[model samples]
Target: MTTRTRTTTVTWSQANARRLDRQSLGGSGSPALGVTEAVAAMLGAHAQVLSAAELAVGVRAPGVTRAEVRSALWTDRSLVKTFGPRGTVHLLPAAELPMWTGALSAVPGEAARLPGDARMTPEQVEAVVTAVAEALTGAELTVDELSDEVIARTGPWAGDPVMPAFQGMWPRWRQALHLAGHRGVLRYAPNRGRKATYTNPGTVPLPGPQATHALVRRYLHAYGPATPAHFARWLGAPRGWAGQLFEGLAAAGAIEEVTFEGVGAAWVAAGDTAFPRSGPRGVRLLPYFDAFAIASMPRDRLFPGAAGDRALAGGQAGNFPVLLVDGTVAGVWHQRRSGKRIAVTVEPLAALGGGRVRELERRVARLGEVLEGTAELTVGAVTVGGHA
Candidate 1:
């Protein structure tokens, strides 16, 4: 006789609150984690905007200043900045670099749709990766410096400006930059004034064949009871491949299927089906591209009702600085710095009561502390557009 698979069901509110708790955004009772610890817990912090990444870590760790976050990345060498989930810049815990590199390297490279002239052949990609590793060894180099070195090592074709960037074309080798990073060839080094730099991170251990499986479990722990499609979206992997991965895990009893309210079928780590009896309650100010806002699934649930219209940018998370109330986005906000003071403007979907108002003030105060500035709160229209 075949055993029927059991599906556990949960309310969206329960999932939200559980994610908040798991992410250390639940409340004041949450422990003040260290910088690396906080980043590791969130899997990684979106870091395209350095200031926002600092705020992301600061909010979760509480009292970890922007300077300290930088220290972890550059001085302490406890965190490494590299291309992370969705092919975006992120600050990930240094110790987990091997696993991340292994898992990301395993992701099938998306076929570049660029014209034949603009794309690098598979052999050219490998050559560029090797050159990048060799060029950055024992020394940090700025983009231009790295480009010159890469060109010298791989001939002029590596420096042919063909890949379009912001307003101009970047070198063909630049296209393989993220791939090299995922292979543990190089990482972001401390900036020289305003110039970004890169350096080889010595040697990273090769990940076991189960590295991808390990990452799947990690993702489910942080944002579980989620569908394979959610995992695909988060990792920027192919949807069918993600589904197959989840299916394999289920077959091995490493994960189990579940029914998420309003979300239909999903999967979570096996035997890990508990949810908090009460939903989370509190106020949180998340900066641009904050990991929690970006990774949580069923965007409609996290940004319920009007929040979907107000907080997201064209259905993409992390475009706006979000205001979280009871584990769901309830408002949008923006901040501007003048000298040592930061002025915060908020536009809530609904009126906040006296208690919540006080909580919001406290959160703003903490944000100021994290930024090493004095912050003033104004509950009104946030006239600013979504950040780039």
Candidate 2:
């Protein structure tokens, strides 16, 4: 006779509180994690907007300053800026580059939906990536300089200006830029004046066969109990592929399925099933593209009622700065800086009690401290647009 595996059930509130604790966003008096440690804890900080990334780290690490975050990236070489989850810019821990590269490289590539003439064949892509690695070794080059070097090394086909970008066309070879980053061949360098530069990060060891499995486990630890579909969306990978990968892990006894109340079946890292008795009990001001807002699953629960309409942009998370009360989105906020002062506007969906209002005031003050500016709070509508 075969015995069925027992499944544990968790409520959304309990799950959110557990995740908040895991993410180090529980409340005041949390451990003062270093910049690199904070970034690693969050998997990575979304850095398409560099200031937002700095604030994301600052809020999690209590007294960390923006200068320290930059120092870690440029001075100490503890963090590296590169394409991470969803193929977006992120600040990842330098030591974990091998695991990230390995897992990202293993993600099935989506067919480019570009015009036929603009697309590169597989062989051409390989050549372009190889040329990019060779061009960026031991030196930093701006996009224009790198393009010139790559075109010279790989021939004219690479330089074809057919791929449309913004107001103009980009070279065909540029299509492989993110792929090179994922392969650990290229990374961001300090800007020269106003121009961005790239460089080779030197030799990165190939990830072991279990690298992808390790990544899945890490994701579960941070944002479980989650479904394979949720992991696929977070990674920008194919849903079916993620499902198969999760099935393989389950077979290996690396993960266990559990039932989430109000949600269906989900998986967590093996033996990682415990949760807090209650949900979070504080206020937080999260910046644009904050990892917690983006990676947490069952979005409807995190952004409930009117929050689903206000916080998300076209059903996509992290487009707007969010106000978190009790681990769920309670409002939207916008910050404007003028000299050393920052003006913050918050639009809460409902009225707050006296204590929560006081907590909100303190949270805004902390935001100013993290930004190295004096911040004043105004409880009103946030008129600024998404990512403004």
Candidate 3:
């Protein structure tokens, strides 16, 4: 007789509710204490746009300030800003760099050819990565300063144009920068003026195979009951590779397959269960590249109908600050600063009850305090997603 496999069925509402709870967006869990804890809890906070990353933590940590996040990155040395999943800049706990780098290395690098048919030879790529790591080991240097160091370390060849793009000439070292970060050797230092700088992620043991597995488990812990494709998209890894990893984990009994209502099959970490059915969540203002806003797949469910059309551009999520009503994207919002006041404007796709609107105002006021300004909210018309 064959032993039959059992698959748990989860409802769409249940899955999303659990996700919101895990993401710390529904007030179900204790708030993280500071940037380091906040970034660790989310596995990593998206940091491609530095300000957006700060806001993402502020919303989840409650009472966290931009200065606190900055201190964590530069002063406290508790968090490190580095190229992470999808080759995107993310803020990760300093000590966990090894695990992140190990996992990120599993993703293949971008194509070697640049726009002008200028190709980076494998040796040049390796040399550039090494030079960047050495150049940033303990010092914080701006882009131009680092470029000078790279040229000194690896000769002018490292500074050749790898591509001709709007950002001017994309250099060979620029291509290797993300790769160096993924290798756990470099991170972004806090801005000292108007210029961006780079630094080492502090000393940590280089990770091994176990680190990659740990990274996968961490991803599922924060955003699981998700498909392989979802994990692949999140990591910028190929779907086939993600699927293989998921299958291996399943075979090892590290995770179990589950099916969601109106959605297909997904994997959840072993012994994990959905949250109990509960009342709806409150309104929230999430900034651009907020991790919660982009954590799951079949984003249509999160951004339904008109919300999808309005909140996503070219299938890209996280370009705009989102208004979440009851755990789903209901609108898009923008903010501008004038003197000591932050003027917030919301454009709802559907009616937000008077009570919720007031609550949203409270949240905005809290955000204003974090921004060190008084927040003034103005309800307005619905608009498409993207920075205003």
Candidate 4:
């Protein structure tokens, strides 16, 4: 078993964070690359960004106007980017998508490593993908319904629609989605449906693993102060396989390990980059799944609840957009849309000053633009300020 090294010191904290896993949601892993630079790299060097609301913070910035980032993830790759570095679906960079997904492909039964019946053969698999892609040309379907339809059609590799043969195949079903996803042939319905539904992959073959490793390395660089264990969890790859692959990459000098606290992890340097520090400037408004929020899986090390809150409450599911005052969750924000009007209300758990309130308003306004509407931002008082 790999050992753990513990180092607790203020001076080394920043570098230490880089040693951990990375979240590929918003930008690159390197603080060195600004938003635009990372976005460009993630979207195949030249890609379109999207305009969406309350996407996860760093993973799904509502502000991204690039179409390639949004539409393609659903349509071609079928895999969504997220912060599994700590179990959140943070934004995943497009280039790195295939490896993250392909790795997931081999994680199930050992049979995954071998070939199966005709229906499960490579030819059959491609046919299933084609038929599913054809079916979802302009519609959405839940996995249950889509898999059933694909199985019944008798197109390429054929299978019985309602037989025991089709039970417990979410991963297989997910593979179809991935095929469709890599092809830019599917997308998720907004707010998602009762079940996860997919749209069409407009056109294009998907990325592969070589691309994924490249992308993930950059993600860790920017969101450093993380670990390899964290990345293994995030990529959803087998620990055994990932180590071998990552180690090979490291040996070739493709990756490096950052050390602190007597321990080190595989890492890529994000030189000359710095996250906003908490000091006289004590707060930052964070989007849900924001890099800062999920940067470290065990967040207590950085957040207010480091030693107490047993259950992890803040992430893609549990927490919404937040108000971070002094590097901790100071409050939460609720965003609502009425046609072209966006309303933002902050429920502060503590007090605040006027300048901070104004700054928040400005931040919200930027969010409104990304959300594509006018906005009204309100900051409630904390104990020193007021109450909810």
| Local distance difference test values of all predictions, in order | 0.90, 0.90, 0.79, 0.47
Show model 1 residue runs off by greater than 4 Å: 1-3
lDDT of 1 at 221: 85
lDDT tens string, model 4, 1-388?
A: 9998443332234443332212232223423433333433232221111232133322223345334344545555433432223222334444544443444333322235323432265676677767777777777777666767777663423443322334443434444445455444454444354455655635443244564455456545554434565555544455676566567666776665554333344354333234323222334555543444544444544445521232135322223456665445667676667998977788666557888777777667766665657878776522221111
Candidate 2: segments with Cα more than 4 A from true spot: 28-31, 203-205
Candidate 3: tens digits of C-alpha lDDT, residues 197-311: 8887644535545776787788877777788888888778788878888888889999888886676788888888665476347889998888877777668888988888888
lDDT by residue for model 1 (106-153), tens: 888777867898888889999999999999999999999999999999
True-vs-predicted CA distance for residue 29, candidate 4, Å:
17
Worst 10 residues of 1 by lDDT: 202-211
TM-score of each: 0.97, 0.97, 0.93, 0.58
Ranking of models by lDDT: 2, 1, 3, 4
Question: Candidate 4: lDDT over CA atoms?
Answer: 0.47
Tens-digit lDDT string for candidate 2 (147-265):
99999999999999988898799988988999899999999999999998999997474564477899999999989999999999999999998999999999999999999987789
The better-scoring model by lDDT among 2 and 4 is: 2
Q: Please give the range of 10 consecutive residues that has the lowest summed lDDT in model 3.
A: 201-210
Ten residues in a row with the worst lDDT in model 4? 44-53
Q: Give the clashing pairs for model 1.
A: none
